[model samples]
Target: MIKVKRVYDAPESDDGVRILIDRLWPRGVKKDLVDIWMKDIAPSDELRKWFNHEPEKWEEFKHKYMEELRSNPKVKVLIEVIRRSENVTFLYATKSPYNNAVVLKEYIESLLTK
Candidate 1:
C-alpha cells in the first residue's frame, strides 16, 4: 500500500519505508527522520518553481509533473521500494495536501494496480 504524509508529522510504526519525495530538504526536518530521500524522483526544479502551490495551477501542475515522472528513471527505484515493502509512505513538505506527494501516491498506486 502507498500513503502520503507530511514531513513534519511524527513517524508511525505503520508508515513503513517512509520516503521523502521533495526535491529539496524541508526546513526544520531532520535527516534521521526520513528513511529514503528520493530527490531525483521529484518534479524538476523548473516545474516546482512554476507551481508554487497555487491552487489555480494544480491541474496544469499535475499534468506537467506526470509528464516528468513518466520519463524519470528514478521512478523505477520508487516502484522497486514499494514492491519490497508491505507499506510505503511518501512524505512531502508542502502545506497543500494536493501537492506532489498526493500526485506521486496516485501515480504509484496506478502502476501497482496495473
Candidate 2:
C-alpha cells in the first residue's frame, strides 16, 4: 500500500518505507527518520515556485508534476522500493494536504496499475 504523510508526523510501525520526497530537507527533521530521500522525484524548482501551494493551481500542478515524473529516471527507483516493501509512505513538509507527495502518490499508483 502507498501512503502520504507529513515529514513531521511520528513514525508508525506500518510506514514500511519512508521516502522523503521534497527537494529540500524539511526544517527540524532528522535525516535518520527517512529510509530514502528522493530529491529528484520532487517537482522542479520552477514548477514548485509557480504553484506556491495555491489551491486554484492544484490541477495544473498535478498535470505538470506528472509530466516531470514520466520523464524522471528516478521513478524506476521509487517503483522498485514500493515493489519490495509492504507499504511506502511519501513524506513531505507542506501543510497543504494537496501537496507534491499527494500528487506523487497518485502518479505512482497510476503507473503501477499499468
Candidate 3:
C-alpha cells in the first residue's frame, strides 16, 4: 500500500522508501530531511503554476494533472514502483492535504488494487 505524508511530519518506519514528490525542494526543509527525492515524479513547473491550488479550478486541474502524469514516464514509473513495493509513502509539502498527490495516490492505489 501507498501512504501520503507532509514533509513537516516526522518520518516513520511504515513510510517505507519515502519519496518526496514535490517539483521544488520544500521551503525550509533540509536536503537530508527526506530520503529518495523523486523530483521527476512531480508535475512540471508549468503545470504546478497553472494549478496554483485554486479551489475553483481544482476539478479542471485534476483532469489535466492526471493527463500529464499519464503522459510522463517519470511520474508513471513512481506509480509502478509503489505498486510493486510493499509500502511506500508519497511525501509532499503542500498543506492543503488535497493536492495533486492526494488524487495521484488514489490513482496509483487503484492501479495496484487491480
Best prediction by TM-score: 2
lDDT of each: 0.91, 0.95, 0.78
Number of the candidate with higher TM-score, 2 or 3: 2
Task: Report the number of clashing residue pairs per model.
Answer: 0, 0, 0
Task: Give the residue spans of candidate 2 off by over 4 A.
Answer: none
Give the range where candidate 1 is weakest over 10 consecutive residues by summed lDDT. Answer: 94-103
What is the full ranking by TM-score, best candidate first? 2, 1, 3
Off by over 4 Å in 3: none
- RMSD for each of the candidates: 0.8, 0.6, 1.8
lDDT of 3: 0.78
Model 2 lDDT per residue over 7-102, tens place: 999999999999999999999999899999999999999999999999999999999999999999999999999999999999999899779999
On residues 6-112, what C-alpha lDDT tens digit does candidate 1 reach at each position?
99999999999989999999999999999999999898999999899999999999999999999999989999999999999999998886699989987888888
TM-score result, candidate 3: 0.86
Residues 31-74, model 3: lDDT tens digits: 77676787876777887898888788788877887777777777
* Model 1, position 89: C-alpha lDDT score: 93
